[model samples]
Target: MNFAIRALRKNEQRVAVLFIMTIYPNKVSASTSPFAFIKDYSGIPREQEILFSTHTVFRVGKIKPTFNYNRLCEVHLTLTDDNDPQLAALTHRMRQELCGSTGWHRLGHLMLKVGEYNQAEELYNELLKKASTDSEKAHIYHQLGCVKDEEGEYKDAALFYEKSLEISRKTLPEDDPSLAAIYTNIGGVYHNVGDYSKALEFYEKARQIKEKALTPNDPSCATSYNNIGSAYYHMLEYIKAVEFYENALEIEEKTLPQNHPLLATSYCNMGSVYKDMGDYLKALEFYEKALKISEKALPPNHPDLATFYGNMGQVYHNISDYPKALEFFKKAHQIKEKALSSNHPSWAAFYNNIGSVYEDMGHYPEALKFYEKALETSEKSLPSNHPELANSYGNIDLATSYGNIGLVYNSMGDYSKALEFYEKGLEITKQASPPNYRGLAASYGNIGLLYRHIGDYSKALEFYDKALKIKEKDLPLDDSDLATSYKDIGSVYHDMGDYIAALEALQNAFQIQQQTLDENDFALSPTYCCFGKIYRGLKDYSRALHYFEKCYTIVQQVLSEKDPALAIIYNNIGDIYRLMGDYETALSFHQKALNIQENVECNPLDCATTYTSYGETYREMKDYSTALIYLQKGLHIREKKLPKHHPDLAVIYHNLAKLYLATQQYNIAMENIQQAMDIAQEKLPLNHQHLLDYRETFEKI
Candidate 1:
């Protein structure tokens, strides 16, 4: 036993290990008597130090709460293998305390406090079955349902909660706190099942009930407030969420002790809302407050501690302090792995979060490695009916990974395969998540982007609208996430030449971002650039240039000069000059954009659109051969970076065909245009304007 303890302290875990069996000095029947005092080590021992002298044995009669361990560990722990009656003494006291039904419930609560969920569940179940009163039954069912919910049997768990509600409704007043709790539990089950509207409905009902029953500022009412807060949080109404969480905290601080778990929960909820609202430092402060109480009140391996760690990790991640995020996430993961099996919903969550940090670092292999592990763990262990299983699948099927792999295939001119995986991921998300779920919105966004890649802006807008409608209802009014959805829709509008719609969307995004983010935030730079492009499309060159300068200044301050996104801003600025017929300025900006990308990306394909812009400029100048050369360079880039049948590839192909004809390669021009026409009609809508143009061009050929 001493050797085992020393090895564990040194962290030298080995397969072969000693086990200790607790023995009682049994004075029972003859056959069981000898067997009880001496037992083999095939057992469970809750603690380690009973092999010392019997003189130190804990006696039953009058005892102190605990002996002082404060004086012990400075000197190395000595293990004596001498026979001792310490285990017998402790066991005798426990048996005396645990002799009745009241005693069982007390011991069971202690087990729950220590996180012995199985023992607690068994004891609670037994007590509930034997319970005599309606109030007791309702309370027992509520707690048992909580244990079931923790086990992720949400529907079955809902039944238990409903049964508790039935009893509470019959025995308790409608506005009783007990009845309000029944409603809250049902709402939580609904929230877990992706029925957020139903969740909101029930949580509101619970709040109203509690508000009527409890006195103003009563801490018991805070449970209802917390319920409402959680529902709003899951619904993505961060501001409203903060309001409710704060209301809960105010009441709690007035009526409950500061160190209570409920107070910590309110603090954590407020912190998460602040974090989502982009107040990282404030989020960190609240998380630390929650952590201080939790560390003192709850066990180190408590599941709530895992949530604290996760929230801390997210706050650090938002601040770009990745090392701090990693440390907290690892601790969260360790505690969760010990407390719950790997397939638990929180376990799946931490794996996805840790994987996202790796994703941000451009470590695609490592990110995918972790995602695959999470998916495998979830799929194998989670019930087929579990919603988290679908979430895991959705994470593994993320569009970014598909887009990356598609680019790889496109580099190999395997456009078909790229499209296949994108379609697969899109289909899975549509089937798995609810209609209003963010996963569904993101899927639509990905499909729209893919359609735009294929030169089907009309089709792109069709999907973008579907995505935007969902995002608008769920995202906060001024949320930064809205920026991307607006930008994507604006780009589709731009391609369709709907300048009014494009300007409205782009300007809305830009205004919201400018309000929410710092002037120098890198994300704001793209928003400015997008607004400039929309203005350029509207033929407002002065306004375009104004926004372009904003973008350029921000980019210069925040991003490296050689960032690939920098090229897009530069080219948009160049386009404004080109449209104004300022050829020298156009060439200057284009050259700077090209120089930056060439140095940083090194892939000619990355600047393919820039080459296309140069070719278009030269064609306007009637320098036909140079235009042909640049357009051909553009085509070679598309061949390297886009699927042969990709709409973007077809656009470049069509441009090259026109340039070829201008250079008098009539037969070659006709051949390329015919292939471009096939790609357009096959991949794009029949009513698509580009499809119409290509068909007309093919007829002329």
Candidate 2:
């Protein structure tokens, strides 16, 4: 290395000889041996990559690329002109002079902020290794824990935080604010693991320590309140959570500026509580206010903005405004897509949200497409057992595909197949998720519906009870989800010849739905239909007619007169009139149902049932010839259009046998009777009334 004189003029000896100092990118001064690793690297690209052991200046472009942790220190700080001893002295003197506590802290903070985490960790490691006091060591450990938390190593974090606390306890006073800081950090780890009780214990510990150390007006006191509120909210204690949240807001509002970020967070938390309580309008108001503030203060693509958009989408979805929901979901999705990397879980999460909106809008094709994309993205980003990976699979199962290709086979009337996917979804939901999970309850309700359709009342009841048990304690008892469980169980009881049980179940369901849902809510129609069918089973024709008429009117009001549900409700009304022996009114109502089914798109099986009812009415009038023709027509359709062993088809087989027997066609009666008996015996229990009726008729044959 070249030496520089203090005052050189044309190579004359005008100054005393001096030792020239040099420094490597490793930050090693000439005073220390260069072998020691004074420089560390984060192993990230686009930074100093260490090379040659000497203090040699090299061109920025002429460097060996960094591999692993060895040489990253030189990549970011390429040496430029090591020939000038004074210039070299600037580097060496900086390293030697900046070696105290302030220098260490500043370097550590700078490295962490600039994303040189490995270098920061190395600095912190050195600080801890050379710490001279318990307080210094505790500070180093606490800072290390913050980095570990950021890296998602919660076990390591807990250890560091605990160590920090232990040392602080031995050295610092019991009421020190440092103790509060450690407690807060430990609580964060517990919260991530879903251990809300442990989280709350630590948060309260922190709060107590903070209260002892500082006045009530301290900003840290507000942080404690906010964190406690979050823990309570996770525990589903919304009232207590709201109280704490409001307390936090009060102090923050009193002290912090109106435009501060903490005020936005407080508004969002209050909005979340209102959303959970099903007060969508109120939730929307608060969420919008938070959105306005965040939009003004945060970057457009910030994660907080994405959260605001997603939460707004939820409010719109709750209000049945699918188009508005789609718009907000898209806004969240675009931000997440750009802000997050292609393989990040956040991108996949927003993909799932947008797909769900497609599902709600009856766009099954688009739903399946996006769900597959989400599943693919999630698999690439997360581990195999990630909860969101299962959700992508579940969404595809519910969104129908080409013909019988989609997740749900509802359009194909394959309720049993749909139940299969529902069971799979439930298993994944429970295994990967927490108790009282809404998705699991939704699957249970779905399986219950399949059992009900197959006339298996016992199995149906078991599943419905399972769903309701999960829902009742978690959601409001009057929530739409619980109301569905009540309605399904009531329908099962009505089908099982338990009218009193059906009435009790259906009435409770109707009351809850009426209380919680909009007056024109579509959920009301099913409850009304269940009530009507229960009355009809009890043979209270007048009450049945009243309930059925109410159902029809409401269905038309909500879904329009030409809707398929309206046609189906009309058929139910016709059945009650037929049972009442009001032939003229029964015929009129049946004709209206047939007209709707024939002219408008309706379920083929339901249309066939209308023919079966017409045949039964003709037989009761003793018009044997017309009854035989109509019964044969119903039987033909049921056999061709329905599953081989369908319960509804069995009903048609029984009616056909009865019509033939009345016409004195004994051989034809025997053939149809055997068909009915085989189907009923295979599909239903011996104690079932359908089987009982068919068995007596077969004995006569």
Candidate 3:
């Protein structure tokens, strides 16, 4: 064991996995030799080696880091014989499911089941040459299709499925159950390429044939129902998705054992829909149920078990429970690390999820590191044009990896860098066959946000409108994503100072949230913040404070004390107090905001907000010298992070002008007011409130 460990440790950069098997020969018949001692025949006698049969089965046991190494682990395995009921039952069931005519065919099917796609494809191609009948050829072609589909070669998968279907149709009826399986697989190929409507058409065809030919509660029918539900889920029809998922779950519950992996999968499907619908508690409940069954039915490091953990992590992440989300994500990552190759596509998603948590925590550098890792892994595992890179399922697409990096850059106020990545993602999404509309929408939304930040309101609206139109056509009216689109549009309107339009859009967003999400859900935080900003813009001080406080309360409940969002909320609340002429209270809140902004790894722009707020409060209190200091600090950050003509820069310039005027510095006041006027004229609408205010300040100077 020591020699093995040392030999593997020679590669310092690569992780090493060591499996130690414990076998009891007495558990099996004396004549059935599954493994043999080969130490005596070895040239190096000091190194003991045992050769195991190809079909040897083992029950995985405890796994832990070895030798205090982060990347090395020891996995314990106990050899299982025919006497092990679970192993025997699983083997029998798999053989039944494969249902091949020969041992070689069965082996090929099993290889596909275990994700040995290349081996399965090679085996099936070889078998095809020797096939004696149409039935045999059809089976080989179908198996090849499955292998190609798993490899993300959707065009090949489709062609193979078509070949199999053409052969099978000559002898099989249109409603034949065997034909349903081929139709379902064809639907899967369409689904992989983001053609959900086409996928649904085939899924419904499979369901219809199953309903007519199979027993009502048959597991095969449940599989069809699950596929239909997944299509609806991707189409953002949550109610229809839930209905089909429940139908599948009900059948599975009645037909399968409590710990069956299929039952677990049904629960996971339900959980995912609820998670997307913003029902976090219900999502968590279903996810935990899936986890319970998966733990009992699967090996400790099974990839399916990891999926359950990742689902729970996503629920926690959506609710802003960062630590719990991190814990679950890390658990999933560990399992994948131990079970899969380093370049496996699943690792890209794991890295992306972990990076998202860090990003939300304002750890920009850490977030960028993980996002880049995800991008690198995706590039290594897939072809550049592989549609699976944008799948939005377990796989990570190249576009998604780029978009994630863009999000971190956006948060750090690197707008040009953010735009570069976002455009790259958009270009990829645009190039996808069948035009992956969902990926396109996400890319559009990201670019819209970037344009909004850089003071290009018209461009922001253009991209945002494109995204909204897609959502309006593709998603249910009350889908959370649709609400996000509305909220984003409302925010842009607020920035443009179109108070009535902003209110209308925000009301639409809030109504959808009220219908789909809990009142205190963190998903509502941004809507509340937008409402507060609109109220403040309208000079409704009391209402603005009320809305800001409401946002603050939910954010406090969801995020950590030092969260970047919390600092932003604090700054907003302080600005509300300043508007209400509560100088002392405003300063106190600004102090709190500054404390967090100064200590954490947050964007410099967020720190600038607190500084500007403090400067405004100090100026109102007639402390001109101190106001100048704070305003200069804010100005320095804004100049570094924002575009010269950004609306936010204009606001800060106006504040500096006010401070200089209060101090009777006429020349400096004129210079500052002129700068503010120039930015406002360039970035804002002619009739915008900021532009009007800048005009008045210019007159005074």
Candidate 4:
């Protein structure tokens, strides 16, 4: 066996000599034993042992024929197997002696690798008690820091790493590998604590040291790149994150094996960057590559495989492939449920992901069930005010649970219940340390949506602006969340008859969506619809049809045929046709919308809106009897289902008045016009074009 002493500093040699002295105090004299090698190397006055040869060289220069403690030296000890009882006995004794220090260090490292953090801490702490020098104590402290890091005690881990770093700076050279490693460890602690700026500071320091001291493709240098990428990723700097991730991947591919776990991590990190950038196809490509490597490198039940499956799930969900998303999510959940403890935060995260998929699919009951499960798991696993429960980027897990429940209630047309849950989420988000702006934005947006549905445009705009302000500050320019805020604000403007502001906000959202999202992404559908409606309000029929067609094409590609969203686009297209004097084409499109509504279990409000559009198309064609029938059908449903002051009801009544006027039923026409005028006066702005038009129609009736 040959033991090579490599990368040892000048002071390290003195420490090693002291350690040898402590282990073999009286046995330092020349003898035919392994301990004899230490005596020859230490420059003590002793004769050479006949059984062994020694090689020692001073690093700086040849020393005088005298003991000089200042000179740095390299020592090589070689033991060869021989058919001799004395040699065997000496080898056995050497193993037993070295086991006290080296064995404990190796065992502690193994414990840390296996996630036995408490055991690793105990072993490292025991080693600290026996550590005789600053170098030895630094190594022990570094190991203890690793144990704390693994246990998620980031503050304590950082303290231990700083202590190790302080000692290393004093005892080791400026560009020592140990100093680089300690800097990286401290950076990891800051990264885990959500301090991306602080994390980047330390990570840059580590990278500078590693670049100076290590080769370009060294694994340690790659780790610094990877850590820097992670910090950028958490900061939502996707382009910078991708750049650093590619750098790490370049080094990893050059040095690591094809199936190395580190290569999978590099690919996974790239996938996350693309995912956040709203590039679903690129995200999926990287995620699949990571999954392939993880499957090859890890066991079927490994947590890394679960992560890959979850990442794939997120990609599918983003692209609106509900079935595929559910399939991947369920696979990930199954693996995580079996691999992790029931109350583990990872299990909660998995459940939350599954719930989000269900929510996007409009399966509200299932969404609520999974969201509740996530909350239950979080309650068991996390402390009451755990920071992880409050996400800084916007969606706090605990607040998300409440907000998601509110969304389901809103979808179910239960406005009061939705308000209760949304406010609950809002209050929780406001209590977060530094306040979870992202969560606050989402809660405010939800409240805005509820208010919009209830026809309170002023309150809706207020909340929507609140969401927009937070999102503008927290999100990047092309972020999907920023697009959503703009979309909500635009929709409120449209409802308030502020067509110019609506067009401006919708165009802003469209520009962002075009930059960041796929053409067929479901999130872009609403932006398209809003553009269509704004153009239609401006009487730009050609532009209205163009946007409505875009919305229709996207929904056709992404949604099922029976989706109620299809009916909305159809109705908008019908309205455009009516405005262009193509009444036959208008009625055909409205009937197509009505057919879908009648066939599917659609929302009654949607069915009523389609009926009103159909009535308007028939009245345009001078089909008074048919127009009255459709108008009455729509009015009956709206009167029963909608609030008396709903703007939609006002529009329906206006259509009924026009139908009655076409038939020369002057008294009934005047009565219906009066109702329309009353609702318009109550709900619309004084100078609104709809109110002016309604007043003219009332005088004619």
> By TM-score, who's the top model here?
3
What range of 10 consecutive residues in model 1 has the weakest lDDT sum? 69-78
Best by lDDT: 3
In order, what lDDT does every prediction score? 0.69, 0.69, 0.84, 0.75
Candidate 3, pairs of clashing residues: 389-397
Candidate 3 segments whose C-alpha is farther than 4 A from its true place = 1-59, 65-73, 77-98, 102-106, 122-131, 291-317, 320-447, 469-475, 622-629, 695-701
Residues 412-528, candidate 2: write the lDDT tens digits.
456666565566556655664334256667667767777766566688899899988988877766566677788888878766667788899888887876775665454466677
RMSD of each: 11.7, 16.3, 5.5, 17.3
lDDT of 1 at 580: 91
Provide backbone clash counts, one per model: 1, 12, 1, 2
lDDT of 4 at 245: 90
Q: Candidate 3 lDDT, tens digit per residue, 1-701?
A: 56556766787776677898887867766767788889999887776878888987777788888866667789999988757766565556555677689999989987776556678888988999999999999988998998878765676788899999999999998998889989999999877665778899999999999999989999899999899999989878888999999999989888776667788899999999988877677888999999998886676767777889999999888876777898998898888877667876667778888899889877889999999999898777655564452344323277898999999998788988998999888887777655667788999999999899988898999999999999888777777888888888988998899998999999998998898678887678888889999999999989988888998988787567877678888899999999989999999899999998898767687798899999999999999889989999999998987777888988988998888887889898889889889888888899999899888888887
| Cα lDDT for residue 368, candidate 4 | 81
Cα shift from native, residue 642, model 1 (Å): 2.2
The TM-score that candidate 2 achieves is 0.56
| Residue 355 C-alpha lDDT in model 2 | 62
Candidate 4 local lDDT, residue 653: 76
Report how far off residue 357 is in candidate 1 (Å). 5.0
